[model samples]
Target chain A: MEQPHGPQQQRPPSSPPVPPAAGGPAAAAADAPHAAPRAPRRLSRRRLLKLGGLVAAAGGLGLYRCGLYDERLLPPGLRVLGRREAAIAAAVIETVLPPEPPPSPERVRTLLAAIDAYLLGLPAEQVEQLRWLLLGVEHGTFWFGARLERFTRLGARGRTDVLTGWQRSRLGLARAGLRGLVALVFLAHYRDAPAFAAIGYGGPLAPGFAGPPASAARYARLLAPPEREPGW
Target chain B: MIYTAEHVRRDRVLQADLCVIGSGAGGAPVAWEAARHGLRVVVLEAGSYLEPRHFTQIEYDMVQRLYHDGAARTTADRAIHVLQGKGVGGSTLHNLNLCKRLPEEIAAQWFADHGLAPLQGGTLPALFAELEQLLGVSELGPAQANANNRVLERGCRALGWRGGWLRHNRRGCVGAGFCELGCPFDAKQNALKVFIAEAVEAGALVLADTWAERLEHDRRRVRAVEAAVRDPRTGAVRHRVRIEARAVCAAASATGTPALLLRSAVPDPYRLVGSRLFLHPGTAVAGIFAEPIHGWRGIPQSYECTEWLDLGPQSTRRVWIVPSFAHPAGAAATLGAFGAEHARLMRDYAHMAALSPMVHDLVPGRVRPRGRFGVAIEYRLDPSDAAQLRLGLVAAARLLFAAGARRVLVPASPALELAREDEIEPVLGALSLRPHTLDLTSVHPMSGCWMGDDPARACCEATGRYHHLDNLWVADTSLFPGSLGVPPQLTTYALGLHVGRCLLAALG
Candidate 1:
């Protein structure tokens, strides 16, 4: 039911430019709608990854040297992350998590599986975007750091340095990208049952205890009889 | 009747007197009001209908079910995490149920500057009272304050600062402490339990798992809505749907309303659809206490510190501080650090309570449609707003120290851990407020499709109707002309009711 694809697919209109509020709190100047932010570029992560692939190809390196399908630990049924993407994600997870009490191989595999499930649940476009993010991290050493080696090839110290650089990068895009990946790692790592147990969280309070139920009669008065059909 | 995508086996065309494109605090109230007025209402909810029994209180599963993008949505810059609701009740499903009315000062500004005359002359107060009664809004007493909330109260008393208990819309909350992940006991008097159910009772048809993709409209009036009914689990489109209606209300969130507007390419000559976006962006400050604070066991946020909050246009301080704690998963994400330091913070999860200082920001951001059914949010804090947030952070640290925190954790790159009260100012004051430098999150994103008298300054009329279209209206926080320096749920409900009345009048 989309409108004819032409001008409609173009970038949405940007805010009219305004000078910064002079000598006043933004709370007041917000009415002036001051200091319109720079218009954002409508670049897809997929397109960015393609450009990165092209850059690597132009650097006298073959596609294989750019770390494609290198990590074959793509567990069964994960349709989103490819083998190399999974390897890069695993490396990023290892670098980003706490070093002490190192995660076991089993634990890492579990985390990867959790991440796969989470990614699988997202919209297809977002899954593609996240795949590109993993790929970008794997191949971004030449751009983020001066090193030409892939992220997975780097040792612990080198990988740490590269990730730290991305985290603190002046380019907002780089920081944003790294932050997104790290957030995924943390979300997967900390949302599990063992993590909850480690942090003394009791998980959900239902089944065992429903927590004093709210007034049933009060809500009962508000509901009308169900119609004959539940679907229209 | 409520229908999910599973019930729709084929592409269908339906007709209704009103087609509302969301079912949150905005859309549900309008549907209820309209259905009660004998209008054939059809509500399209892009998410499934989850009952209280369906709420498991599990953080990860609930977030996946209730939140947009599985709770991973961020601004285009990826600096700020934008947490919005996706289910039938929208954010009311997960919100802490804090009920605060729009400040009169901001309303006066809208009236005087934006020509929103209906806001004044005792119109809004009456409407607010009606909504408060419907939702059973009540002020929490000291008895309701948990150990986490007591941190704020004790801090206020120790520092001689201004703070008090907040009002909420829960009737019989047992303090299960998972408000951000849907309520399990159905204690929250939210849109799902109240308005949407009542609307259905009044004969409105709610189509769950139905995504409104476009508004079919001519130059003057919206004639129909085009939608896709998708599988809730896989998001695979099952059937195409079109609902021809006399009126359409986009009660989608602030981000969603504008994205829908731009996606439909409705006649917007002034280019005002998604230009002025405001997120009351906030960051949490965690305090390490000697004793256990079991911060996740009781009512999440009952106390608030308002010493630093001023709603005036030229006010220096505009931070609304409240006790904010998350589950173990959320806490780990909020706490910064990658190595042993991160482990050390997690060990003290049982002894930590946190406070979030939300800025009453004025910096306008932008929202545009990205890929189909995706929202591209472009927002960055201006220097003034950033300064205000920095001050709020400092204030939060001071309050934590005053309440006898052994150490305070400021979520920044290489996170600041101050052990002494004197170290708070010297350490936090020099911190830079940049995109990725600080961890900022927003629960409130508003004012994208704002209302005003002038066409140049507003997308909708003060009556919440689109100025360029006759039968189109917006009923959400997107109608806010400026930042509401307070929780926007009560106001959103009131506006939905107001718009519903206006649309009914127009229909007549």
Candidate 2:
């Protein structure tokens, strides 16, 4: 065995030790005058998942280069969801909603805007969980749906298939991930007034009452004055 | 008087005889009673103060404004949806106002099993009567049943199942059909419009948009309460508030109360603070009728069928059925389909009626504090409870069919669509009770910091006093020894009053 690098440099052993790198401890050992020949290494599940993650990230980067994930698509002053996450969310909205009469570009943007507004009210921890959920759904296509493309790149039928796979998967995480995204989509889509007209909902029951205010100034005006002054 | 984050310019301090952590059904009465006794009281509410004028009656907007976690708070595994409310009045701001007393059987069970004698005592009934008078609890006539409630009523009559109209805490209800989204017409006589108002009039200072961080305690005595007043739009901590009080009451709901206790690190040798959580988990069944049901037009839930509900600990049937409908957003999210199929179902929105079977679970779940102001709920359905729910689903389908529904849709994965009565049994019989297989939501989350004689098994005494800490008390549904197999708002109000008196005596 090789005695180079002063007794292997005391490196922590990997699960299945990484294949020797050039000028590394294992490589130094292999290249030693008395070292034995090395055998072929087999890949483990953990290693495969790491590799998948890198490959998915690379695929995402490639899609970004293609201008699919435009950060400017998100409106200014978004407190939570990132631009890439918003793009993925838009794709999800397109996939789950009715395809016969496709949603207009403006409608999709409105839904995304509503989600962004909604996320502003949640705690950062929950919003962080949501970001992780989006990442999993985007990169999990190969693992869950046996597709190599990211979620945003998966066309309508492919995306549908992937979502169906998650909905029926034995793993609870997969089912929950799909459910979280679908809930977000429905929440934004069905709240729009156009959706009401399509479904025959007569909107709010009150006559002179307006819906949610469009600006902060309007919301302030809507708040009623306090009943009495504070004792302090 | 009330204050929000906007009213505070910098970190401030207050000295009070009593400090209440919430302004809900539980905390409001306590504040009112204590303030009336000339005790300087300060109340901290985590949500913003939005009166009737602020209520938009829009599902998305109100859900974000009034509900806990934008009504997106669910179990850790995403198995069940938990709908808790935030705001000056807590859940009462958005609750349907269905007021039911704790079942007699449940009270007996608590006394027998948990040694909760006070719950089964004579004092509680008087408290209930008084609370009812104050809140104007009354029953709607049979004529008040809209097409949605009528479906349940007609079905119960046709099948000879026990059912009737329930009482509510509303004084000027206008059938706006937007009770779940706070009442825009100021119809609901909830804690906000009733007790909290009275408390403010009695000089209790309520600080909305204030989040309680921890109870500064010295082993047995809670010395002070530390909190942060957050900017409403950005959720940033704009001001800090510290209150030194003789006593502190935690009226944050089941989830909120337990999380607060755990965060405060109150002495609990048994680790019983956040354990024993029970969610009255429920799922709905939709029926499509030839006549337009227009289900979302009147009081959301007024009538209920109790054939399957018996509040005994060992009872076989444990589901309470009520007419459940949703606005467009909730409907699209709950219905079991997507794309063209879901769109087709939405077209029949006006012709659809719904019935939800809420289970009275026996097994307990848990709640843990996630961060400073967040909760992590871990709840899974017990097999027995799930079986009862399945049975309730079958019964709901039968009722809808009996009421002349053209087609009944059970909101299950591969949603069971039954056209005839014969199709109900075999279809739902084979349906699995797994998490993703059926859609479930819970409005009532109770009994996390439960009350009992055994300190090892309970978080508080029957009088809402914490055993480990003398000056700390939990006065919300967190004090329930077991699941209250009914809407718990009315009992919550009564218990709040009881705990207030207990604290008043302790202070004296």
Candidate 3:
């Protein structure tokens, strides 16, 4: 089955072209032996209309089955992964990014739901590729998960350890994928959630972090450090 | 019972010793100064104050939340895309934090030509010293620099093009390389953290989501300012506030300040109020390398080329090449077209390091009032400026190739690509630098409302006070009499500080 290109699809060369009836007025005057005869004049207009309708219906059905109506038209399932893989992936992300104080389990669940929705919306071919990518993550996490689960479900400290290890090994590809997925999840949650407000993180939030404070007292504090106490 | 002010419904009057409008680079500092001087300063910001914690690590949301019109605002001719910040910190909140002082030569030119004698040698040095100390401008170390920047440095060194570390107003910057998205780490120093926060703490009353409409003048003096306050979240009309001050400063930036004055009909017979606009047009060159550059993992811009600044006429627009990385959507939009080929490019995201060279030209644009309070700008790039753009593009392409770019994309119509070193010049030479064929944008916009000795040629006087109006003053980039040839932030701050002192003396 051929995939549909944007708006300009070409027909196969084998298809016959529709021509005017041969052996009619002009055809008869320049007639050669190969000129075909005209169709019978007795055919009704209703019959012609019925035939056209049938052709249109057939074409529409063909286009629909070829994924013209659906964005994701998968080729073949490479593997049948278990829900446990997805769950384990979520557990790892949570471990890597421990929720801050006002922690809401709802936020995590919402984020997961959003990621699933985004994945479902992707093209079938892309979805297949992404699933493969996720499998790579699953493989890497399998051994790590067992050891992590054995020790307090991997807090921020443990997550940092895993991240640092990955960085030192120069696993940039895996890190990019993980970062992309995490960013997407975080964005979806922020946009969908009503309780949160967008923050100005990039450009100019504050003056130079190391510059003298606007206030004299604050400036002085920046220069001084907390005093060390005697050991008890 | 529902009440109505003289002009608009749902009105309330607020009083303060000084009322500052717009809370970005300019107003933020002015408010801080006034409040610190024991004056009751009220800052009216058109955008909301967003906290750092609320900033997401995503590109799309970051742009939508931080950028003006989600980074879609442009000139009427669409020759240049202008990205401004709308939230509390303003454009400072979304800037790359490239802080550099205005060149001395440019300062001297303004002083001699425009009669801005105050900005002469000795005075200029003192002002710059104060500005630098206040802003904490410094250079990024090798550890803070990213691999992407190193590629530019390597290319410049190989080709013998001068380059050095770009100074930035930052401290404790971990180099996340997300400066364009608003620094989540609070490392990039913007006015909000330094000036605005300090001002608020110093007893300045900042009213977010309030837009000043028109000035209420009594003959030759501005008696008060009328504004419409709205809830930023819902866009619902909250109330109308009237602020009365002995001095009124319009620090609403290049675009906003001009629109305000034009709406108030502040008499400019010269018709130069919103004219002589200069935008440092820039374009980027992306290089794909074999090794993982991880461009997004380091500083967004840590290096630049100063050698190009003194390049003689006919030399292409010179600029310091800096490293940059965008969010996925932005990356995709810039990368152009989506498919398996695009996906392969994404796979090598770690290998891509980008450099943008910005050019300065004397070609001026004008801003006209649209309706009553809005503004519509018209810009036309001169032939010489166009040539400079082409020159910059060619030079950037060569540098990328020298740095071993497997593939380079030039952001122009009929986008040219170079795979080999030999094909670089031919591809760049074949390109047209016409205004319509190229994609140009500006982060720094100055000289829309100029200050000069002659009111006939300038919008305001040397003191930044409007020609006819006694107490009305302009304290933003709009007061820049001409192009500073470098970043305008330091000059703007210095001039603003000078204007404040002048206002104080006059009032006394």
**Highest DockQ against the true fold, candidate:** 2
- Give the C-alpha lDDT of model 2: 0.84
* Candidate 1 lDDT, B64-120, residue by residue in tens: 789888888888877899999978788999999999998888888788878877666
Clashing pairs in 1: none
The lDDT per prediction is 0.83, 0.84, 0.62
Instruction: Give lDDT: candidate 3, residue A180.
Output: 37
Q: In candidate 3, residue A23 scores what lDDT?
A: 59
Residue-level lDDT of model 2, residues B1-508, one tens digit each, is: 7787777777889999999999999999999999998999999999998877677777777888798888888899888989999899999989988988878898888888789766666877999899889989999867677899999999999999999899988876778899998887777888876877767777788899999999999898999999999977668888789999999999999999999999999999999888888999999999999999999898989999999998876799899999999988788778746777678888899999999999999998999999888899998898998998898999999999999899998876545688888998898998888886777899999998889989887888888999999999889999988899999999899899999998999899
lDDT of 2 at B383: 93
By TM-score, is 1 or 3 better?
A: 1
Best by lDDT: 2
Q: Kindly list the interface RMSD, in angstroms, of each predicted candidate in the order they appear.
A: 4.1, 5.2, 18.3
The lowest-lDDT stretch of 10 consecutive residues in candidate 1 chain B is: B333-342
Best by TM-score: 2
DockQ scores of all models, one per candidate: 0.20, 0.30, 0.02
User: 2 or 3: which has the higher lDDT?
Assistant: 2
